[model samples]
Target: MSTSWRIRIMLTIHAKLVEAMLAQAHKDHPFEICGVIAGPEKSNLPLRLIPMRNAAQSETFFKFDPQEQLQVWREMEARGEEPIVIYHSHTHTPAYPSRTDVQYASQPQSHYVIVPTDPAYGEEIRSFRILDGMVTEERIRMINSYKAEWELSMEAMVA
Candidate 1:
């Protein structure tokens, strides 16, 4: 496997996970929510949800609770997993990344998922690959199950 990340211009994630994240975002309402969907390290698959507390607790921004983040990261490491998707909600803002988000993005390989609690957009969830300050929007193929998604990906790889 290549040590360097292979960035995808598009991705497929479970609609269930998307629904869960959107619910979390709505629950957090005016406050931004954040989390990670982790999978086997280097799998390029986001297989589970790990909703995180926004330490900032601001409507306009989000910051992971330092302790929670530390614990989560360690747990994923122990499970031989890495964050395949790093996600956050934007309350009262567009689903696009903010200037600060662009500056703070540290995961070039992980899909940066955004859930906007803007009722105007009906809480549409979007994904992007944010690398070196450049944010490239990605296609999100919502699937019913991760297994189905994984099998398709494997077939694509084989083809």
Candidate 2:
């Protein structure tokens, strides 16, 4: 039994969305922001990202808006995409999950990607899979420079 895990992610997005997210994150200096990533699921990959509309308030914490998320999920389904991961940024903290994070993380199968923007570690990103209060570090595989991948094969192996 180990604590390490990996999440395979595929990224293909409009450049504007990414820039907007980064800019927004940089602007909101001390609050954690969140968004969604959507894409098609290949043999072993899934598409996911944080949504901009929900990221405006990051200091308090984040909770997915069911209606908005459902819309994205439905949109993905219509476009043959799958919601594979959930991403959020930690304002001035590490990417590690907080106690609240553990309690609030309700998704059992989706990978959680955390972006830590501490001054000491700008743009530090990491992923984890939280289940039953167990948090494990998950490796991120970049499918390409513009596209990243996270494969949960390690978790599967452990399970």
Candidate 3:
């Protein structure tokens, strides 16, 4: 494990993004739903939600359609954006990265979010950083709007 993984970081995402993710998960219940949230490069802010089709289409696993993945990547590059957050749903299990997820985590910089759709688990969305097969849970700070959140932070800093 590296020192960077030990640092406690908060994932500040807009509430609408969260809702959209949850909705997608619910719509694809029993099967895993996966997607990525693209943001301005180096911003660490997730702004655009792009839900992807699960090529595997299995309840236990998810794999992005290769063509779709390439298209999305190209689109993000054209827009000067990066995949800041990669999200998926665990229909029957808790929101935690599995061994396969850790092994396949290609973007070490992106936040890996797991949304649980199991009725027994209640509403809990977990965020993590999967780097070199190490998974580190992160806190989420949901805000109504990015501008409002930024202004509040600026005010607090000035005070």
- For each candidate in turn, the TM-score is 0.88, 0.66, 0.88
Full ranking by TM-score:
1, 3, 2
Please provide, for model 2 over 98-119, each residue's C-alpha lDDT reduced to its tens digit, 9 standing for 90 to 100.
Answer: 8888997876666677767676
* Model 3's TM-score against the true structure: 0.88
* Worst ten in a row by lDDT for model 2: 3-12
Tell me the tens digit of each residue's lDDT in model 1 across 1-159: 322222255777887889999899989888999999998776677888999999999999999898999999999999999999999998887899999999989988799999988888566788888888898998888877677556655655555
The lDDT ranking, best first, is: 3, 1, 2
Give candidate 2 regions above 4 Å deviation.
Answer: 1-24, 42-50, 145-159
Candidate 1 — which pairs collide? none
Off by over 4 Å in 3: 1-8, 148-159
Distance from true location, Cα of 131 in model 3, Å: 0.7
Model 2 residue 153 CA deviation (Å) reads 11
Q: After superposition, how far is residue 44 of candidate 2 from its true place, in Å?
A: 4.4
List the RMSD of every prediction in angstroms.
Answer: 3.4, 6.1, 4.5
